[model samples]
Target: MAQEYGYRWGHSGLTADFDLDGDTPRLVRLARPGDHDLKGAVEAALPLVDVVLLGDGTGWSGPRFTGTALGPRLRHRAHHATYGDGWHHLTVELQDPASRLAVFVEYSSPDGVPVLRSRVRLRNDGAAPVTVRSVSSLLLGALPSPDVLDVHRARNDWLAECRWYAEDVRESVPDLGREFHGHDGRAGLRLAGRGSWPTDGHLAMGAFTDRTDGRCWAWQIESASSWLWEAGEADHHTYLSLGGPTADDHQWRHVLGPGEEFASEFAALALGDGFDGALAALTSYRRLIRRPHPDHEHLPVVFNDYMNTLMGDPTTRKLLPLIDAAAKAGAEYFCVDAGWYDDEGGEEDGSGAGGWWDSVGGWLPSARRFPGGLRAVLDRVRERGMVPGLWLEPEVVGVRSPVAAELPDAAFLRHEGGTRVTEQGRHQLDLTHPAARAHLDATVDRLVGELGVGYLKLDYNITTSAPGHLAHSRAWLAWLSSVLDRHPGLVLENCASGGLRMDGASLAVTQLQSTSDQQDPLRYPPIAAAAPTAVPPEQGAVWAYPQPDFTDAEIAFTLGSALLGRVHLSGHLDRMTLSQLGLVQEAVAVYKSLRGDLRTSVPFWPLGLPGWTDEWVALGLRAPVAGATYLTVWRRGGGVAELLLPVPHLAGLGDVRVEVLHPSTAAPGAGRAEWRGEGVRVRLGEAPAVLLVRITAGG
Candidate 1:
């Protein structure tokens, strides 16, 4: 399709229309190929690059934004691209003649994925310096109006991460009635995250859908630092913009010297028929962008002695039995959680009273805790046919740690006024500094090479606020890549006090992500079900802690939470009875049988994106090639024993067959499933129970 005023390029599974006829080359449409042309639906004109210079302000009369003024004045210079390795890259050049400030909009996408990744680069071409306040990685118009569109967002926090909610666009940005007012509304809904914990306040993702038509657009800002996104009415239609840390939202600013360039963090967008479709597309894109690792494909079971089991107080005597039990349960990796380096015998056993909280940083095993050296425990792990793993929070040095004093002050992230920044009794390490990077490299090399450790649970516990967080974040990502390059086989788990740094930039380089530190088995369903929205199922490590005291239903409930994703098994299996251990073994056996499908399957929520306190929740994984569908349903204390869970995608198959994989029918209150019209009705006699069922078509 050719545009009369500009050009329309539809290739490699995506469509992008540019209005080159104007002084500024605007992205008129970004959607699926052969889809409806948005040229007629575009109610407002928006520049492809939303940038704010030092002097130039908003062109509109309402909220300050990077939509107009300097953006609209940028003249199109050239456009080019490259292609290889199942990926396509395109770059559009735009420059401001007055200030000699040049902007480059870069876009990339996988061969067949319905998602586009975008970013912006700014350069100073003039002799004078150019100060930039804000720049958007992606900006687009022609979205559905508030009257017919609904927006979905997630509020993230420790233990309660990935809590999704929906609201009408009018709820956030009131219906200004642009037609009657004779102008677009300036006010919009702005969502942002500050500090090093990128997802501490809210997720760097959002989606909007047409209620009647089910058309949806979902997006994620792939930044490990501060980010901001906004949506509002523009020219009768809504527009959405994504960006990294901005001057107004995060106290970030940069003065680009002559011939200097700066790149914004990447953002991705996916279009689909509904929320599930968009999320499934996003899942595929996530898999394509992440670093390739055997762990993602094998989907190994990790037994970490944290959460409700060890609680970060690892010792040889405490871990040996657990290691044996985990090996018997079919866990491929055994991880010794925190407190491994606590030389001081703090008063508390599993509590923070044990210098474990404030006196960290020396990645060494404590002789006092591990009587025969940590090597003995590690050797036992290997002897039991499991890889040894250790936990390390490499980004921070405790105030009481000697490493803090050994490294120079410049190695730590400092405030704008040159003061060392501290949070939660730890000083943040600035990976941009050579000394800090060296220290981390040494720590990891010793853990992997010297101690024969195969896996490392890299954690970031503190949230430090400082200027230039975006730059620091990029440096951190580079360092992570370097480590993986040197130790190609070593596995790294990206954890930030449990899912705080759950962003694409971080997930792209790490093998696994801790979905949450939520301890309660009952409260973990929503997090586990929604984690695929931010991460691929293979990379989202969901904890399944089944204790000896738990009943058969309780055990099934905990283990079922992680059946569809990467299983991070915890709990004191060492003390469980034969029957209890059998239950745990049964769950692991089922997981291993179907783990291969996780790498290729896309996620769907039959119960709709779960609510925090919803009584019932359902997550479906459908493998397109295998012609198989697996569903995990959790019933959290509701009287409803039967649920008619919708599975429209699988309903097309004429004959559907169901099988209960876990807690076989012989078990008390075993759940069963049967296909019905457009869905399957699952039944569990108990209120607090879980069921894992597999359905096949044309049986």
Candidate 2:
């Protein structure tokens, strides 16, 4: 194949003429059969969305798009047409389903000019390298993506045809009969028209925008035998980009030599995160979620039992001493977990789980151990100058519980024998259902009203299982909000086994979650290290993995991460030895001392992505009005990292002093003072990280 069709408005590929004769689009001299007028057709098709501001497909009038009969401006490609060392196959095909769909595809440059040289390459007969490029498109009749601008190039647009070799086509559909039909929006490549195969989604039309290279341009990609063209820029738009994995479509195949064929073939890409607007839009959304509510009284840090391994504490009085220690250490709330129930068997009590049921289950404290009950514990907590907190596994219901007995058919996803199964634990209540809410409502009342607990740690062990579903998060919010309204002064600390359901929506109901259940001092830092990568530093990576399993030094370092978010504390002080208790006191002291600095800084993930070595360096900067530049790095791994602090759009702090606060063994994660203008450089030797507390002075 040498050269095919090159029809242009002014150049080769396509020809565009004004609607001289009654606006019907004139053709001076036609070469093909059909006379056409497909100029400015993009504007007519998707009138709502425009090309980028640079070029918006404005200078229309180009190729006359038609089917069956060849139009005056038909475009195709040919490669090595005159050479002998070539195997070429020319096939004219119709790519439309029924009479209702139309196709409008084209090729564009950064300037919004269509790619004119329509060249389809045919190379070496037996697996030889071929310089291939595909420049083509098909526009839908009237599907409009309103917010998009035409400045986008081939990549981030709607659709594209992946470039392929002779061995790429599974089985060519040679000459296909064409039957024109009515009009359908997805006009790109008609699935049933050529291959008679079903498509993933109705693809209307695709176009182009940005024309820069690499970060902003489109290029065809091939690894071994597959061909995929990267099109569509995902800035300010939110479309699912095919990035890491293969797509669901199995339509593509590589035509290998002889009996070899291509299967597992599909094009994948990365799409934008979708857009609402500017950063202001994000701020507004945040404001709505973190709105000040009198109903949500500040609940203090909860001292948990699981990580502390203090569950079923036979010597219950041991917990009292720990409670006193924590109270002295400045904890505003103390909660007793599972073992303090009325049922002997409920939690090592051997009293049997008689009270726990589907209807009002997990409502009672283990009665046998806490023969004194949850109320007595609350009274003790209050005497220590802290609001009493209680832990409740709200989303789960045990089959042997009384609450489960009362819940109706819709309350939980049930089976024959009242056995409810779900993600976190047994009997997951479908919060989206009304009956589920009612069950949760009654349970919350018993805990909030009867138990007199001012704080609640809602436990959800199951990660959500609904796929492609949007209602779960909001339904969860409704449950939390209802609880808030009932208690009116309770702080709902969220926990799902560990940080499972932590996302944008979860933030709306509760402030923090027990980041990880293990809280092994050795384990906490690794997870905390990855927090910065997933979320901004301003938000809480406040994971509470400080099990009795950690050394004192580890505990202190883990608490330092509180600057990133709320630090959850779990463990009983009663069981800790004197030295361990002293360590907790010291760590708590430092956290309180640095609260102001930690609250104001913006955390950044600088030295590349957080790797699996349980190590990540986090940097946060606080530049409010006139203040010291404070930064913290939680390095889980000990390595000499080139500490490159990222200061993308951060302003102010022109000249400031910096210093590292800890560590004598390794270089300071924060030590010494340096006035290095806005950008301060430092070396954080093998130590986890260097904490930089900057102070500015000038009149």
Candidate 3:
């Protein structure tokens, strides 16, 4: 065995050092190769694994570890390392003498990728059982103090999502003169989430960068529900702890019997030069971990007749014309959104409010809406050179739905004892139940086998927070993977009331993510520009709905929102004039030509990340191998006519060419772009206008 003093593990582009000289091994250094080594500068007193049990409460009364006694008593036992499939896996086992709990801090990282995935495993070696209250998937101490670090977190909500804001860490966790008190403060910044909608209130990611230097670190917790992350001062040094469900916050308790083992959720961390660099690394890591799909490569443009068009009320008459228009507009997939399965003929006014909300679980086409059978509409979609799709919310059964009564009570999620969990008159399906999984499998198989649904917009509109959310979440992903495994050709789009459940876990299994439900043409720019921060560009499905009454500028503004990401083309194209429709067609064409590079490209913000109400916003996709860069700039109601977007990569390269790729004929007050010193200067004379530009080196 290696000496129990200092140990180092080095792999592709990553270096980790542990201080085994102490009673408990401490992860003193973790960084990119040749980066700063965090040792001696700060004490290696923090434990590599932090755990909180039912009776062994924290040593300190805070979200961090100062109060955790078990953490300090966890002595180094043994470690094993292995490599397989271009990934390095390391598990360090530690034993708490008093509790006789064997904790394994497991870590895995892809070769040459500056990203690490962490999780914890626990095996009870004691005579009696122990209840685990909370455990950290990854915890790091001795981070740069708040004086030199600025924390970055995104504010998320219904339509407003991925809005990032940066603040000085000192402001959030001020210096409390702990030297005088000899103890860490009891307060810190905590970003947490519960319920079924993981990203309902906030995203499961955060970052911190040095104020002077560009060094930065970012991390994301991969959990569908009930997760907590906190950054606080421990022994005067900053510490970050990330974990899944906890008893204190989510009423999650796991009883580990003798010899029983349990594993926590996975969390990933990456390091880069700055926010953009870190996010780019994270973007690459997201691509690495996601399920492989042809849709990611082809990036087929989907036209959903819901937002700003049919509004979920679909019928044979209403969809036939739209299908033809969508085909003409270059959409490769046509998805008939919600209300397609409304067998209960209530009121059909284009707005899906009548029987659509509470009477949902049959997954059958409406005979009344489709008098000639839904196949005729689907056939029309296929004839238009587009694949057919349907909307489904498989995790819920409406109170009045026949399937709700047909399935046994055990099929639905419930409280710890027995009561079923209901949200908004809908019972949540627990995929952990074999019966629930079978029901969903049957529904999906029927849709794909019988109706020839090549695509499915799997939406979850209800939120439930019953006990056993962690297990149910894992089973849900397993069920989704199993469905995809069986129906290999079927593409799934993950949507939860628009970006509510946008997490790495869901995106890893589903092919596409609906970025938002924002209907207004003017309000989508910010969301579109920052979507790639949480989702890969090719996987982020952004809606572009252009109405007939919209001006040329309005049409370009909305369509430009999706050019850099997956084109979720919506709107009443059938009603649009030829001139108005031409713009949509041109934008779709531009997306197709650019999408091939998006899968391999990395996103960058020439002008720092956009603000919620920023007058101007820009999103860039740089394909290094292709030697091309695409920029989509939106000028939304501002007096500033010119934007100097810095493209550092193109800086100092002589004779660069900038071309407006969209809006074939510019509007009356059109936008213009040209090569400047180190960036492109885009001038848009009109408000609410957008331009898609291609930049390349030229003679």
Candidate 2 residue 574 C-alpha distance from true site, Å: 3.8
Candidate 2: count of backbone clashes, pairs at least 3 residues apart or interchain = 102
TM-score of 1: 0.97
How accurate locally is residue 276 in candidate 1, as Cα lDDT from 0 to 100? 91
- Error (Å) of candidate 1 at residue 601 is 0.8
RMSD of each candidate?
Answer: 1.8, 17.9, 2.0
What local distance difference test score does each model get?
A: 0.86, 0.38, 0.86
Clashing pairs in 3: 58-67, 59-67, 59-68, 60-67
lDDT of 3 by residue, 1-699 (tens): 242337777586676777866887887767898786444433834788888888888877766533477898998888888999888888899999999999999988888888888999999999999999888999888777767889999988999999999999988898989779988778888888887999988899999998877898999999888898988887766788888988877888899999999998889988888888888888988998999988887889999998988887788878989999999999999999988888665133444434667777878888778888899999999999999999999998988998988999999998878988888888899889999998998999998999999999999998877887788999999999999899888899999999999998999999999899999878899999999999999999999999898888888888888899999999989999998888888889888888888997888998889999898899988885547898988888865488789998888988789989876644577788999979999888678888889999854
lDDT of predicted model 1 = 0.86
How displaced is residue 577 in candidate 1, in Å?
Answer: 0.8
Per-residue lDDT of model 1, residues 1-699, tens digit only:
467536766465687777876766777777786566544554365788888888887787556565657888889998887878988888899999988999999998888778989999999999999888889999887766677889999999999999889999888777776668877667788999887899997889999998978988999999999999988877767788998888887888899999999999899999888999998889899989888988887888999999898887777767889999999999999999888888776222433326667778877788778778889999999999999999989888888999989999999889978889888788888988999999999999898998999999998888866975677788999998999899998999999989999998999999999999999998999999999988989899999999999988899889999999999999999999989999989999999999988898899999898999998888999988547898988889866478888888776778778888976778977888888868888888777888888888873
**What local lDDT score does residue 423 receive in model 2, on the 0 to 100 scale?**
36
| Arranged by TM-score, best first | 1, 3, 2
Candidate 3's TM-score reads 0.97
